[model samples]
Target: MNDVRLYSKTDFSKCQLTQHPLYSYIQTFLNHDISCLVENCRNATCYAIEFGKELILVVDAQFQAGQTYPTSLRAQYLDYAQEELALTEIKGQKLLSGAFRLLKTIVPQKIDEAVYVGNYLVSTNLFPNFTLEEVQAIELLLNKHFPNKTIVYRSQNSFLNQELMEHLDVLDYQPFISRQVFIAHQAQVIKRKKSFKKDCKLAKDTMFDIRIDFDVENYTERIIELYSQLYISKYSKINPLYTTVFIEAMTDAQNTQFIGIFDDEKLIGVTMSWSFDGVLTVPILGYDLSYPKEAGIYRLLTYFTLLRVNDEQIFHMSSGVGPFKLSRGAEYFPEYIYYKRVPSAKGYTCSFWLLQKLNKILIRISKKKVF
Candidate 1:
């Protein structure tokens, strides 16, 4: 390929066997996918062949400006085995490496260092009997590409790390970070479900019936209204990825499920959750700040929705900040992130390494406090 050009999400949506992901999480949390994130810089217009063997989506950020797609690719890989999939396996589901691999493959511009992005972990069919060697292949490929870049993943427990570094694994898999948190899936071993009743009585007194609805489109404006109250505050900033249009896209009846807190006639709060074959994801949630003194809506929303869900055993709760989610009866979880850098090549290696270590330490220290 000459150089990867940009392909609009619409264009890619037309590919055969292409299933557009519920972009809520990415849209809500990330600025945009690879292309938009690098719009000002030169990048690739990659075509994914399907979440294939050991890989899901392969995003070629284009190729080197003058280099050819060499007959033999000196590349490195990272996938599910040590990422989100790694966490899944810890929870007892069979896993194969297929999530995203940008961390392993993104190399510096000079020195023939080119990076590729991939994540194939999310599969409709469960992959069975996964071994540690699959991750070895990913690491070897990534190291080959950068030569100097170090591969680091916070989700790795020691046993898995040793397996990744046999003598054949020549590249240095540096310890750039430690003790990262994997955000807990809400459905992992559900305990007895409970919701405080006093909150409901308060709603009843206010003359609004508290009803939860799966049909989110019925109240898109209200959903946005509550979301804005939660997000448009001193601690919040606007995310271009989650425009009103994107929110509407998520509400497309065919795509997402919503749970709303309503008065007999007025909408008061909303929580939006999504489902894959087995995993339920909560991407957006908020309550009206009008009830400032009481945590009623926050606690009430969780209870109603948690109890109503048919399968609560495999849910992924997006955990962040603290105090509120920590106390609302949802359990705490650690979310993991990894990075690759070459000190000599790009030279962000050591600087970033130190930064990650202190950040991890701070996070662990903060976790001690709960409401």
Candidate 2:
């Protein structure tokens, strides 16, 4: 049996995610202004459960409008679906595409109530170790406080043991893959792909300076510029808000690593990576698309990202770009977005029907069968 102690507010600050330099750096880097690492959420309360002194689970009991709801609840999945299908380019049908993007922005404006476990992007493993009893304990605690609301527990790139499989009604989607470039075996890893090999050489031939742990102000406009390109490339509605949040995170030097790629004193690319415990996460990365593709700006940035990871440390490349990631020797794993809710009143069901209609319309517009 595991000895569990519940922690909340300031008490949870001593946990590994915050104590370890890497995790602390990235969380602060990402949530600086949009949210705080150790305070009440914009529309909720933040809490955690610990076993002895090590933190086991962290969650937010959200009850109103907020970033996590509008972004994570749906827009993220839509962005991935669109990217995978390569339908980001808005061409001849300007009015239709414009309306679609507008709907994407409006749909997530309200989330009623929910509990989100793991981090915002759900990139890290929330349960390092698991048991049915422990899961039940946490559920009961949440149920006691917000019995009527929905619970969304996201576990990215982690195993779902038999106990959890049996206990929760899991909603499985497209698998989310986390990429890593382990520096300890860089030589072997690099040889896996001919293109990667070529790209690395191209990167070596190019002249670009990569600086780490810098000021957000120096590259604020550049970051926004590159990110906007990425936003159009991905047809992302979540980009505007995330772009703002990311700028705020880049300012915290203690918890953020801001890598700026410059050519002759002009910024060309930026990769923002955060670390916690021994794990590193590259949540935001952007480069000027106008630059020579052969210059391999992306390849150079990726090469340096791998250099930061060693055998003992893990790197989370977040999600998407399946074949490219696999070619580079990054392992793939399933990430689930679990939803549990008690039977709701008639009005809630009506809202569900309306959401279904919106979902179907989106599917039609994207020409992708999500169901």
Candidate 3:
């Protein structure tokens, strides 16, 4: 049986991370090891649960005047969010019994070499309880739907959930797709109640005048030109999601805000934020590199973002690799992910028959990849 209960925001500290099933890096963002991972689409709130004890704390981000709390109480800091964003209520029991679960709501910001970005983006996350045969059955089913996507059988996110992974024998399988998925989230704001104030950094003898555009259509191509520079500068290899049409489509979505900083005629940096409900999350930010002496492009944009959106909405700085945003009062909010899958009917009928064939092939392929 799974322990799923809800408590007030004050209970997050009582959470013990050592027992949860995830990686060590998450400790900075979550109050307990037993956390929940939700997409950045809604007023995402985090529920801290002690899977072993069934103890749970339902904490949400609230923006109240003069609200403050210790950093350790993860939810209290959520009060600093920019607006009144509502998140999905944790359906305690329903979550515990899902038929299938997958990891990676989105891709993390930082990119490293040789890591499979596809796996991070597309791997089907499952809990740690099924047998090896059961896992293969699931994969075979998915292959039928997404023949082009790669699937990796990876470990439980942390120890609290490790047993399920161990029991299922999922971590042993290799990835069919080559890329690792990356996930990220950040704060987005409605127009604030307060004034929009920004400390603009202008070069003393500039050829262009600096202007800000709320209309994305005005500076989209320019924004991409600037962003592509930062991306190419950082990563030796590039992902083609940066094409002009793609950038324009994402920037112009109804629930998104694509903020731009222009140097008279040239675009310097752009902040592309996605929205749902009232929460707007900055999923991507890019700047022009030729203006290295003016490294202030992104910094100026962020300040403008906070000051402009502070009074109305809360910003969602992600759990991974965002020191700049984190430093500007974005606090830690723990998230958890759960996976459970019941084999499809077609396979269940002939489990004994297919297991025999799939298991033999799996072992052989695994050895080939290893050697």
Candidate 4:
């Protein structure tokens, strides 16, 4: 078995990641502290670990400083609990609200001691193939290094990481459904969905011009502003608040592709996506919400995104906009965060056990609504 080696920002160059596929992305992560680029990641520290051919990014989050769900475990579980509470309130489920309120009080302190393996701090963290031996080796390494922390692997779903999830399950990791994500295969969606066909037609008929070959560097600030308008303003501020520096790094990166939707040569919408192992994931997508809805800017962007990827590849649209994604023939799958309780950290273990139970109930009740 190959040895597991860890690299910090100070010595990341020694890992010789220049030849790696995600070199540019990893370099950006190290050069600029991830927290500065991502607002919710203030309390967490990132490290890279090399295990054979795989380069895994790890996050050590001991404090509950972030107000968002992605970086803070407390926030992650609470967000769902709160959503469930709201649903129960709407349905007059007063009996369940008390239990959820208790969860709100207990979850914050208990779930804070965690170290996430394979965390990219993005919407999705892509993984390379891992043999059972590799999984065991990495588990052992994490257990030794982070003895008092709950070991976690975030951004996993059966659609993409079935084998990895199975391996973790075999190793006694508890799987908690974090959220439901939508995935679409372009050829299939195009063939089966009438709504998708209409969207494509609308995109073609729309006045906005979609440009694949443009100076992405020149539009960094605009991209950030547009992205913030949707993701931060319209949506919850809990989402990663990406900056111009992050946009610049993405444009400079070899692996990512950018598409701009221009209204009379002015960028109104943008998407930054990357493909790995024949699967495409768009981490950044935003448009001018101020634009009239009749314009169908969002619809146009989605259609162009489908056109951007190969017909054979699957597009992981990520979570949210369930109705919109479903209209385009996207299939929903429960995304999970798998974790192993450290025996020494009994407090976190008990809290995680309780969280697991809560998640099971929440998953059952909100399954349809979440998608």
**Consecutive 10-residue window with the lowest summed lDDT within model 4:** 83-92
- State, as a TM-score between 0 and 1, how close model 3 is to the true structure: 0.38
155-203 per-residue lDDT for model 1 (tens digits):
3322223343332234443332222222223432223322234443554
True lDDT of residue 344, candidate 4 = 65
Tens-place lDDT per residue, model 4, 231-330, is 7776666677887878877887756888899999799988998777678788888898889988988887788777654566788889877878888877
The lDDT leader among the candidates is: 4
| Number of the predicted model whose TM-score against the real structure is largest | 4
lDDT of model 4, residue 325: 87
Clashes of each: 31, 6, 56, 0
For model 3, give the 10-residue run with minimal summed lDDT. 109-118
Ranking by lDDT: 4, 2, 1, 3
Question: Model 3, 155-258: lDDT tens per residue?
Answer: 23322234544533443432121111212223332222121122332333334433443666666567656655654345312222244544444543344566
Misplaced by over 4 Å in model 2 are: 1-51, 56-72, 76-112, 121-127, 158-187, 215-217, 232-234, 243-256, 344-371
Task: TM-score winner between 2 and 4, please give it.
Answer: 4
For residues 234-341, could you state the per-residue lDDT of candidate 2 as single tens digits?
Answer: 445433334544466557534457788888888888887756555666656888989877777777777777666566555565555545656666655544445565
Q: What is the C-alpha RMSD of each candidate to the true structure, in Å?
A: 12.0, 6.7, 19.9, 2.3
Clashes of 3: 56
